[model samples]
Target: MSAFESIPHFDDSRAAAGQQARVEDTRIAAQQFRQHMLNGPKVRYFESFDLITVPYPVRYGLRNAFSRERFVEYMHIQNRLFVVQFDTPDGLKTLLVSPSDHERNIETPFFRRLQDRTAAWLTKLIIKRQSSVPQILERIGLRPEDVDYITYDHLHTQDVRRWLGTDKTPGLLPNATLLVHWREWESAKDLNPYQADWYCPGGIAGIPESKVIGFDGSIMLGDGVALMHTPGHTEGNHSIVVHTDEGLWVTSENGVSVDAYAPLLSTASGVADYAKMIGTEVIINGNTLENAVDQYISMVQEATVAGPSRRDPRFPNVFPSSEMTPFWMFPGTRPAFYVGHARHGTLQRP
Candidate 1:
């Protein structure tokens, strides 16, 4: 029997009870996460509503099947939204991260084809278990239009327009500058071909190349905020390090979850690129194997630490790797305290 068939009937009271228990478990987990953040070393933290949940099958389909799988998944997946606020000597500075505006449907023909295939598979699996997609949605109580203007770790095509709108809004503290990782804005073409139609000639192209800041090892964005290049996943990936009265806080664009820091397996089955494979292995391991497998792992880890940092003023190349700091914001981690520092050097309280 398939994995779906091994479970109890969907309508069974026991199964229903189990589902309720799962929901409660998720809520408890979220609550604990918030409480942990509140008690962390940081001075203050702000959280927004959790609007949407990207279905696992859909996430899998997009990441493995989409043309620009990595970029797409990095920008839009598991749609949760939140913003963190820190207290600085200057006042209150907010670090907006991980705010997803909307759940997108695959509109292009290529994506549509892949979606159709996955939908068919989902239909069979779900129907076999006497349930439907809507039923699952009902269980989760997710709304399509639930979100806030928080800084997101990943930004998709839609996010750019929304950002522009937000930036142009009048009477808001003009001091707030959108702190973008220098690399994300630079390597748009190589990372996402679909975005080429928009980001290429007329969009980012319209902005003078002179305004683009390539990777500097680190740059003070005024008021103690810093932009650091932490490359690995892509040439353009970077991290934002903000210095507050409380402490130094770093926000990474591609730094999704703690698991992302762990070693990744090869991507050889669906879309295979030998160069990417070698490069990825080298990045993860630091160099080609010259010893036993375990020894090689150790060598890679060391190399990863000792490798030369890559930062180009014109290209947005930042750092030796994306995993710069070992610390992560998990459920039980302590928060840091710091003073407010704006992206453009102005200090403000919100």
Candidate 2:
């Protein structure tokens, strides 16, 4: 069944999108509480699993946004993708952030495939050592039906068709619904030329609507797991926040590294030096046309949610999902930033 035939459609423009988001968030809260009294303040806790690590070219991600010698030069840095399993008001749920599953995505939409093929052979050096969602699920002794939801901070270069299934391909996550910000979904419908290369051509088309979920502003999937609108990287970009026993950890490329997120309060990462030298507290991921104003606000939102780490009062509780390492030094097979205790166990019920 095509999305057009089955799913209910709600459309909004960028100008009015924020208001719509607030409305949606409030509505979701009321419904969640009424149905399942996971109410008032929540003692949030969850275990995070590393799903995959994507080795990406430096210039493509950080946008030469750092003061590192490599930013002045050129290189590639790898980022991580992870899954968080936690107890929700409804039941046990797994929330996946950044499903960069396909490495040699030969099935990429035609025009994009052509561009990638030419780039790979000629100019750019793009290397992706990836593990598919199914592979990770199996490793964890679970399946597609085991996950409750799948989402991304933004839809940069992502092909929803792979997960949602195209006319030819069966939906990979049969029981899981794809959650996205309404504005991000709108951008996919009509994207600017700059983002053309990253996104799959007609990627969102023809998917079953019933399998997709769109939200505005910030929303709680249940206690401990929430999707917050943390724009700047992309107009519709968002961050997934989960409260573990340790604290809240946010997943988004808004800032390439932990230092990028808290430049003022951190000096652990090299980018922090750049921010200090420049006398500017705010730092963006460096790629994609960004709204610096929006990014500044978003960082604060992330930090506020994170509060202070119990481990260290000096640092905010928040950590980078995509920890930016100095590409020149550790060029291959680096670790991803993750949070809380983790396990690859079978899905839990009630």
Candidate 3:
């Protein structure tokens, strides 16, 4: 069966054709999907892990703004790994999102080597990993082998050989399978010049074909967890959508922070002002400009699906995989709000 046929997607054909039409259709379909998910089960357990903190460009953070010089040269972003487990008809399923290998990520040709060298030099000073994935799993009464599936918003700087194993070495998650979008899986292998800088060299090599599962559009893994194709940052970029007691939450790297998703409600020094001046609702991640229009629509789709935050309704229930955090060293780049970490339900023990 085709990947799209493996899992059904919400019907967007109900609405007319156009940019606004797509947004409206997605909103309606996502609402129905969210209700169906809520009727099912909440995630068996949900937790976040702080992987590493790195610098990003100001121009990309807030795009098409007149006052780009108002903020610092670079903004600090804290990357996170999410462990989501839920019940399936077959059994329990554990899914990992954004499990980045920080040490090997330096191979990314950021800014054509200038930023890569800068990140390398600053590694000891700032880019410290809070904890390794294995350590976190052990502390939580789990093992790497327990992971059933591994995924990411996009491949970008990701190298999955360590997780799934290569011919020369054994993998940490011996039982894990990589769930990737067909477009993204293809993009990683044949990267163009515009896409090469953000990707780690030879990132997806030496993995057995049986260890990878490719799909298209949206697919519901089990009860409360679903993967939605929110392309734009990359051709195959997607977001993790989960339903919980607090409501619905979507995770992706489309935006760096809550402010980027809800700029009108943002209290950050200049974010709200920029949005008002530009008359735009969403502030994109802006690093990749290949399919900007698609990215904008995708961001809107995410914000619409996620709805509002429980703690603060002013913001959308969206958690950026690489969220912007406050740092003393980086002034004027502090996030207006931070989710810190999202922990929900109880972790099931083997």
Clash number by candidate, in order: 26, 2, 0
For candidate 3, the clash count comes to: 0
Better of 2 and 3 by lDDT: 3
TM-score for each predicted model, relative to the true structure: 0.38, 0.72, 0.92
- The C-alpha stretches of model 2 lying farther than 4 A from their native spots are 1-65, 68-76, 104-130, 264-270, 326-350
lDDT against the true structure, per candidate, is: 0.30, 0.56, 0.80
Clashing pairs in 2: 58-76, 157-198
Candidate 1 accuracy as TM-score? 0.38
For model 3, what is the error of residue 14's alpha carbon versus the real structure, in angstroms, after optimal superposition? Answer: 11
Work out candidate 3's RMSD over C-alphas. Answer: 2.4
Clashing pairs in 3: none
Per-prediction RMSD in angstroms?
A: 20.1, 7.5, 2.4
Q: Write the per-residue lDDT of candidate 2 for residues 140-252, one digit (tens) a residue.
A: 57677776677888877666776778667787777777888888888888877776556766667887778778776666666556677777778888877665545555567
What would you estimate as the lDDT of candidate 3? 0.80
What stretches of model 1 exceed 4 Å from their correct place?
1-43, 46-49, 55-77, 88-90, 103-158, 166-176, 189-216, 219-228, 240-257, 262-350
True lDDT of residue 226, candidate 1: 35
Candidate 1 differs from the real structure by a C-alpha RMSD in angstroms, to one decimal, of 20.1
